[model samples]
Target: MQDTLHGDSQATGSGQEEGGESPAMDPRLIAEVRQAAAGDRAAFESLIGRYQGEIFRMVYYRTLSRMDAEDITQDVFIKAFRGVETIRDPVMFKPWLYRIALNAVNDFYRKKRLRSIFTLFSGDREEGQAPEEDRASERLERKEFWGWLGKFLTRLSAAEKEVFRLKYLDDLGIREIAEVLGKNESTVKTHLYRAVDKFRCEKELCGFLKEEKP
Candidate 1:
């Protein structure tokens, strides 16, 4: 997987220029989303082409595994294709798509948790433990960064983790995050602040917070 932490802002600004002005989503894209919602297969493929990179990045940030992220990204779109017609407002497509992506990530972890429980009961060792030599290699740099991140996240409650990821990793604002998480804005703010305070106390992550200005 790519070192997504440093490239987040750039990925968010992918097609935009140096002045920070973002062009509006193409009207054609909106039309395509609506058409896809109405069961147009070709339109749905167009929508996938438009948003796949962004959705893949979002999943990759959460999973920290390129292969898992790719699989989950495909799953997200599959769900969207099945449920698109249920969407009421075409203007809300981006957020709606993101909501699906968030749910897919949550479901992925839920399944993983269940598997862990089953593994424990069966007395099975976990798969994919890297060799000590491989663990020390520079090839694992991104994985090591995720390990550091996992340590910081372990201090937060589940709610805090959801809010923090939506705010920082997915780049959603307070209102948007509240809508996605089905919480009120004040609740989202509370979780975000608590999460930030925890991060602020960690010397290893303090510089990261400064860079993010969060």
Candidate 2:
């Protein structure tokens, strides 16, 4: 988790120069973070209300499990409430919060790996059985799209995958992504370029690329 939070202050920014399509954090959000850090419960809850959906979507894209995403999203806010004071710049709140989220996702994968090991040792695994689908039939179209996207993502290297998701799915700018992933801007761009080249080779994603063209 520390590895995901190790960038220098030079990587932090929140405007056009950052390459972020999304607007910078609202001035109101900056004030809310400051108040929350001062131990105001309402301020912290307001912060949660402001970003919960985006955080949940980030987790869901990575985990593809509704229950796991919800659980992790709650954990993220709890962790943030406890550690908000550690944040040096209130304007960097979104990237800092995303760093916490990325850490939570990493922890989830670690625990899942441990569970797999335990299941192997105990011979308790259910073989040749599909995992139960938790999504509703009404959301089948969305689920199918994510299913295909997940497969496409696997084709990217881990670094490329992270960059691609942050830049495209999360709508983060180059500098914001650099801060969140603790990478330099050049390294982030390299990964994004490679990921795009790989995506161009996939027939299924070609239409997506075309549709996204400006």
**Winning candidate number (TM-score):** 2
lDDT of 2 by residue, 58-80 (tens): 88778866668889999999999
Quality of model 1 by C-alpha lDDT = 0.76
**TM-scores, all models, native as reference:** 0.76, 0.80
Per-residue lDDT of model 1, residues 35-124, tens digit only: 988999999998898789889878877876666788899999999999999877776677788889988988988998999999989998
lDDT of 1 at 60: 76
Positional deviation of residue 110's Cα in model 2 after best superposition, in angstroms: 0.9
Off by over 4 Å in 1: 1-10, 13-26, 121-136, 208-214
**Model 2 alpha-carbon drift over 4 Å, by segment:** 1-22, 123-140, 208-214
